[model samples]
Target: MAEALADKNRYAHAPRNADWTIDQDWASYTPEEHDRWNRLFARQARVLPGRACDAFLAAKQKLELSRAGIPDFAELSERLARLTGWRVVPVAGLIPDDAFFDHLANRRFPAGAFIRPERELDYLSEPDVFHDVFGHVPLLADPVYAEFLEAYGKGGQRALRRGQLHNLARLYWYTVEFGLLATPAGLRIFGAGILSSPGESVFSLEDSSPNRIAFDLERIMRTKYIISDYQQTYFVVESFEQLLAECYQDFGALYDDLRAQPDIEAHALCAGDRVLTQGDQHYFRARGMAAE
Candidate 1:
């Protein structure tokens, strides 16, 4: 990580103060940054509708996102709060899990304040503003998904105290960041990380290289993940209601029980899985692990 990213000193929680105000250096967004947002936005808008879950597509439409430019946080927050009582807050990037949970518990989402440099377009190790706002924020407009995020935030704080933050984070990873869904249309992209990228949006749904299993909270928590590449397995939920209903159930016992089990393989599919696609592991196998 760069010094600018590692120095936690520059980082601050979004929804700065009780007024819920975010001071994004809107004018400071460079032409290249805006162009990146525009390019990403145009490409995704075209790819997402049919392949993305109804909630995701609906939320994206409700927000009126465009390829015109990067959105101002103020405008986005205003519109989102109206729809789901949730707001977007600007942050320096990758805060501790505690801070991340605190913001979400209060209906505030902390987005990275910076954009990726132009040279690293296809990928960047750390999240940039485009990934945070464009990738994640649109789905926050849906009431069910918004509520689920706030609940996860609250749940995270408790899990952190019990030394179960890892468990809670897996819940988030399997849902918020890299989750899948079985919609009336078929398997769809709901995870923002997949939703924002040109290549991933298509690959996650169309690729035969990754496993797509049904969402099982316990299974998700125990499942290990790959950090070096695209996911080897993606969990699919039936609906946002199914996801929220499952999470709202007390996880205390589940967490306690899971702590005793060995971590599941990243690509393993258990008997309970409502298997969507049994991936062939082509992507990861083709590229061996690389150094940071």
Candidate 2:
């Protein structure tokens, strides 16, 4: 059953366009596909209120995401453009690193054109339209985050030229995908990956199993992250402005400094880390013991 399911979800080749883009064909989505999207959205919606950052929740309503069904890219683009000059573009699947950076640099978010299968709703290897559009798009409405993404995109192009894409990717993994915010109400989620996953939504904040360390640019850049599991350590920033300020500068020198340093394990804590929550790592240890 697992083998057959894997085969069904496998991609033989990249989708249509030369640039890896395709028309969203908003009308072509079948009822089943839309239903899958609704299920994913509804599950996240129920758990996100106090957990998700204020910005995400505000934008969700602004974009009318809570209304019904999958949103049309054209309509979403119009709303996003009006807010922050950002727009959503449809892609077949993952695009090349350079191409991905190029899109962000221009304020164009390249989203996968498909939705996850109903059977694989909880886990999928690659991000689908629901993940791309729903998890990420609303945040793009905020001006600070919008500018930060464009800067990260531009910075990514330079990283590729410098052979520092790996380091740069770590920054994105920790911040854009799995970052947390220290808000007035306490720690809140701004990262798309955490906000999109119902299970992680609770585990990230409530679970006593993962480290919640303060965000440090160099610390995050040198850290390794898990691809197939929840992050063992999540970096927390005080504000979006702070995040933007830290990332706006040229990383050329920092990248040079990083090349000499050994990479930090995903869950390792350094002496200078501002320990927000020193997790017991119960989940991680359990997984390890099971593997053994």
Candidate 3:
């Protein structure tokens, strides 16, 4: 009981409700905090126009996310709901996986209420208001992408029941966080993690250091990912509709098959992979994590 009480207190902000949501309290942000937001916004703004997906860019413009300062959830929600029936809700920080899946399942995006410190603007270890709102919120305005997310939310429980949540998590990580999209114009960014980071915005598309593989449900589930730094590989989707159709299914059979197969290392490519770029692996070699 004592430990449970202690864990609950760790939230430490925003007076959380049952859903683990807290008030954004837009008024509480300081001038310095808003300045950090603008700086982060400005960096991504310069890089995104040529790199980010047409769909994501269109939705971002439609939602008017380019304006100054941290967005007020109340105002952002009003605009987003009008477009796709989805709304952004503020969270104290990282909520439980169940709560996260539940929020997405119900069309509520649980964004971190606080902004990252000024010192860590270049790289924040956890998802902050900028990463959540700037990286993710715009895609929520796209109908096809938005529907895919909701479907992913609804399918979470079955994976949990099968004890294959890790596999399911890879789906989100590969697609939503680090995904790339192939366009007639060329490969464009869609994943929030890539779209938001100024450094990676160029690396994921132009650096030729990471494997850009075509999206495959089984392959992504079997593969590992990097969190602390850039991905050694990125999966590219043909379209949001293609991703939705691929994932919208009973995965019991897939789970059974995957349980018997070995997990792939983060940077390794398979013989069967539809490789777009084989990746020189120059970056990982410099770090001594990849050889051959």
Candidate 4:
């Protein structure tokens, strides 16, 4: 797991502080860097209207995110605070789990301070400023989702103490990173990991290669997830309020009960799942056959 994390964060800039934070130095960004942000923003913006959840789209407009270039964290925080009491803080890269949880618990989001290079435009192992800001900041504008994040952070801290961090991490993965929302129109994306990537953004909603299941708290905590590729399944919530209500409960006993059960594979669907869309497994199966 440590090695996997290292590989995942190989591209992240090293931090100058113990807590993995650094000054954003918004003034120091080169024109090319700003151009990269603009290009990535424009690409995702064009696709998000129909693809992103209504809450996310509304938040994006409310935040006025199309101002071009990377956002100033100070300015972004000011605007976000006004809307939802959330603040965006600059981080050198991915920090320790405890530190991350602490930040979220305090209503502060630790965003990467650098942008991805042009050569790595389509893909990056580590989240850059574009992914952090463009993907995550918009959603922070929603009051319910913002509260859910804080609850998640507090839950994370408790989970860490109970040796249930893995379970909590899975919840984070399937929700904040790759969660979906079911609306009257159809399934929409609320996950930052899916929202930021042009390919995954489309593939998550339109493709027939991944499972779309209703958000079951225990089921999600028990399910495993993949980091190197697109998700095999996405847990969908009815609304941000639903997500918050589900997570706000006491997890102490739940964590104790979960420790006795075996983990479910990323691609395996358990019986009694409020299954929405059954996936073909085309993507993973093809990859497996290629490996064989």
Candidate 5:
């Protein structure tokens, strides 16, 4: 941790403020970077139509994210603030957890100022501006989801104080980053992790290899997550209101109990789970086979 804080290279692209925000310096992005953004945008455009939730698609259009290459944070935030009192701010990269919770708590979404290099276009563990803005910022326009995220942000601060950040992160991982939604048309992608990925954009909805289960607050907190590959399971929320209602629950006791319980494997199914699809786990099985 000490070494990380002292690393000068981390802050090379943008000067970090006390709060860890940096000016997006929108004009500084090169033509090549802009072209990459366009290429990524076009890729998702082909897959997201029937896959992304209604709110996300609508917000994407309203924000006019496809108008150009990379969007200027100032302009994007201005429009977002009008709709849901949320603002998009630029960060050097990943900020400390406390700072991140603070930003979300205050309706400020801290996006990475950098875009991934051309070689890493297909997938990246570290979020880039495209993932932050293209994947997350759109949903900030939905009033209910906006309220839920702010509440989650405030909850994060409390979770940190209670030494429950690990548990809290699963909720975020399952829902915020890789969540799905149950719709009449079928399951749709809502997670920025999926919305921004050309591969996940299709696999998440169409593939039969991952478990799809209904969203349960306690269950989500109990489950482990995969960081390096597509998830072994996906949680589906009924609606934004359904998701927002989860924020109203008292998590103090929940956290305490969870500390005493063992974590559920990412691919394990519990008795109470409302199974949407019983994934064959073929993806993981195939990977295991290939490794051997």
Candidate 6:
């Protein structure tokens, strides 16, 4: 039989062992672990100044993430609080949805406490400190994006009470994890998943194999996404304020409307879509992870 889910904590809860609590042994991280953080941080920083959303770059600068070693949570949180009301909380690994929601609702971002092992630089089965802190934290400094996150967390709780969390989580996945943005300069990345990964950074915009459709709030909630690999279809937002304003508008009614309608196919494009790049979907088809 499958193992039971991990225990729920003040940070998160999940029915499967996906929920994790923070128990960071700050001083115990090996030299190699700190090296990994430095390596990943430096590499991404070099690439992000131009590719990342302005808000993200700014937040990263404000937070003063270390290029020499893994950041101490206390130090990082202090910087974050001065810019936004957000604070970073350490976690052992994934947390229960409710616990995750509660943290976000309270403006506390739960970061996976552990860094990945030396061998798993390219990938890991779960989010590591790199993915959680590097991928997600910078955007938290953007006030508009920060508000959307808090709203998203509050929405998650309501969705859980309504037994519609699966659908709601999908919305978070597509927008927060794999989202893109449209700027006068062309397309750019704001999503944590794309922001952190070097391969996806190239694949998402420059590659000819993935679809880039304009952002639509309802459409995003209805669409499916690829979790374990690069996304095939990326929703594009015009601006940060647009995403927050559109998303924060009462989703209660939108949620009801979605339940009453059919879910959009994962790969299907609608007539209403504003096509930025109509990818061949070859990269995803050849390398996509099986749907979760």
Cα lDDT tens digits for candidate 2, 161-204? 99889999999999888989999899999988998899899999
lDDT of each: 0.80, 0.88, 0.89, 0.87, 0.88, 0.79
Top-TM-score candidate index: 3
lDDT of 3: 0.89
The global Cα lDDT (0 to 1) of model 6 is 0.79
RMSD over all Cα atoms, model 3: 3.2
Model 3, 1-292: lDDT tens digits are: 7564333323344488888998777898888878888988888888999799998889888888864898999999999999999999998788888888899999999998787776677888878888999999999999888999998998887788778999999999999999999999999999999988999999999997899999999999999999888999999999999999999888889999999999999899998999999898999899887758
TM-score of 3: 0.95
Which portions of model 5 miss their true places by more than 4 Å? 1-13, 289-292
For model 6, residues 62-166, the per-residue Cα lDDT tens digits are 888667788888788888888888999888677788989999999999998677766678877688788899999989988889999999899888998888787
For residues 131-193, write the lDDT of model 1, one tens digit per residue.
888789988988888889999999998998899888788888888888988866688888978
Clashes of each: 0, 0, 0, 0, 0, 12
**Model 4 TM-score relative to the real fold:** 0.93
lDDT of 5: 0.88
- What TM-scores do the predictions have? 0.90, 0.94, 0.95, 0.93, 0.94, 0.89
| Per-candidate RMSD, Å | 3.6, 2.6, 3.2, 3.5, 3.1, 4.5
Candidate 4 lDDT for residue 228:
80
Q: Which segments of candidate 4 are over 4 A away from where they belong? A: 1-18, 289-292
Worst 10 residues of 1 by lDDT: 5-14
Model 4, total clashes: 0
